[model samples]
Target: MHRRRRTAVVVTSALLLSVPLLAACGNEARPGAAAVVGGERIEVGAVQSKVKAVRVAQERSPQAEQLVKDSGQLTRAKLYDLIVARVVEKAAEDAGVSVTRKEVQTGRAQLVGQAGGEEQLAAMYLQQRGIAPGQLEDVVRRDVLVGKLAEAIGATNGQEGQQKLNAAFSAAAATLDIDVNPRFGTWSDQDLALGEYKAPWITQVTQSQGAPVSGA
Candidate 1:
């Protein structure tokens, strides 16, 4: 009877020691999701699919080749932006703020009128920016949400509101558990944005007067 009791204690201790290992293994095992936001898995396959769609959308531009050579940049950066933007959208909802299609359209129309009308806006987005009208609309949607959320939170005027909105989003993002697949890089808490990770390195090393510098 004593032998069985001793064996049971040994097994329990083994499991207790293994618990931390299991946590590390859990992180390693999830090599697939591009990001895990809150509890939702933003799948790598879906991100790539969206990337492809964005590239296809830009194909209508006369400058498509130059845009493609620019590293399919919109696909790369916007996917990260979209992920972070979704987090902001959640925060906006919690703040009881929302934007509608009409708001986006009305705001966009005002901008169009300000920019000297529709043709000018088209030239700005498509020709100069190489962004499709549909893509611009997506940008408008996020912009409207941010503006509305900022206003609701008393951040309604000038750059002050925008700064306040940034603070609010940063606070919201900090409260969540977020992970990014190494391939897609890291999420920046400072910017509440995602970008490819770069290992920190000294861009320039300077020596004060009479100081010696050595390299291996």
Candidate 2:
């Protein structure tokens, strides 16, 4: 019985030692990075900066409390957005697609018009997409890229076409060799997702002119 008790203590000690060692190894592997995509580090600091921007914008809004409550996972969401941006860029490059600054400006202008003004557009984006007013340009640029990518790949305006677009993004994501910090979550190259966050759907190129073509 004494021998069995000694063995149990030894086993328990081993288990306890392993936990910190594993954590240390994880931190060492991706130190300071929220994720690494295609050998490029998405720094944790960058994610925090984005979250800060959104928080500042949310605070200025009348629905500040609700906005904060809704975006409890703001850090992860921002990181996910950064990852998706790289994924979209990769897919666009693979398809010989690109978005000009002028295109982004035009797209933003159209969205502002649709939303009825700058403030309304900002509010709409903040409420629906968790984007800060300052960050809206980047999001619009990504949308333009997705639209052009859809066009370049011959993806149509239907479920079948959406699937095809998704496959393209998934392929791009796989090639990136994305390695996310385990604290945030796992990266799914197959689903183009970060943990519980499923990849955003691709908007049809045909619909880009009617409204803001959104994707993560």
Candidate 3:
């Protein structure tokens, strides 16, 4: 139980913040940083592109209405999530955590079996989660990496190595000098996650964050 909490805080939430010692990345005043993890710039444009691809995939699929309906929330959260994903990558590298392509393939197969088959897994990811089939494998690979990281940090079936792992994650995030554009939200020290903050006018009414490309 404690191990799960620790790993969830350190690696599982992957972006989920935990542990009380995280110092919010103080790079807000720095411009052009959609997010900066360990001083590496994750340009706003990169986030925008990823969102574009997701939107494109959504538009082409039959789930257009739900995709459009959740665009605002999805775009924002997914952007933040990707930024956190970068942070996770750096932390994993530092901890020597890794996964092979075969591992990812095997994991996906196992998940497919649990869901009854590939078609079913695709439905859950696409229809339910709004993630495209093309991106499903990427999602599975990330989970595999997160699990390896947890294992490396000592989050096993039953163990007490979470605090140390949390410390490591905090150190990595802090040192990376993370900063988010104010247009998105503030970085939360408590949750070790990005908290969305939008302009009053924008928040006054719910609206689409971005529209599908004219041709796309």
Candidate 4:
């Protein structure tokens, strides 16, 4: 009878020790993933690579210290951009919107003209948007795609149109089933945002062009 009691106590200790281990396993759904969107992993290495590119560009800029200081949340920002890129792609696909190579080139040219030169354009984006020079083309393409997607959905030139645009993006985001790693931040479908950073270029470009969400 004394031996039987010892065995029961041993079994209970083993079960108690496993509780924490099981909880840890539950938290790591995909090891080394920053997030999982549409059942695909956004690996930590991919996010770090983009962040490294931005840092490299910033280091070469005249406002290197200020740029780096301002983007202290650079990891989260880059991750946000990565997640939004996928969201924009899905939204555009659903809206039957497509951006061509010529459109991207034209968009870049227009921006360059506005900023005075290609170097100035790079500086402007890096300083204002935390976007690296190497990532500029992707940014331009996404911007153009957003514009086309807005038009395709008949997102008119006002608040109503803005609401439509948000709806389209929100729907796409919801379908993606975005799951962000706790170390970064959370995802919000309704806001079409990652944590506090809402969609940037979309709102900025729309408001600047005076085409949609004028007050926004």
Clashes of each: 0, 0, 4, 0
Q: Which prediction has the highest lDDT against the true structure?
A: 2
- Please provide, for model 3 over 1-216, each residue's C-alpha lDDT reduced to its tens digit, 9 standing for 90 to 100: 222212212112112222221123234565555666666776666666666666787787676777666555554555565655665677789989887898778667666776777777776665544455766776666655655676677644332444444455566667667676555566653245566332110000111222110100
lDDT assessment of candidate 1: 0.51
Which residue pairs clash within candidate 3? Answer: 13-16, 17-191, 38-176, 185-197
lDDT of each: 0.51, 0.70, 0.53, 0.66
lDDT by residue for model 2 (1-216), tens: 111111100000000010111121145777777778999998878888888899999999999999887777777678777887888899989998897898778777877887889999999888877889988888877776776777667665567767888899899999999988887768787766666655343444343234443322
Report the error of model 1 at residue 87, Å: 2.2
Against the correct fold, how does model 2 do in TM-score? 0.83
TM-score versus the correct structure, for each prediction: 0.63, 0.83, 0.66, 0.79
Displacement of the residue 194 alpha carbon in candidate 1, Å? 2.5
Model 4 weakest 10-residue run by lDDT: 8-17
RMSD (CA, Å), candidate 1 to true, equals 20.6
- Name the best candidate (by TM-score): 2
Ranking by lDDT: 2, 4, 3, 1
Off by over 4 Å in 1: 1-28, 111-123, 126-133, 156-162, 195-216
Model 2, position 181: C-alpha lDDT score: 81
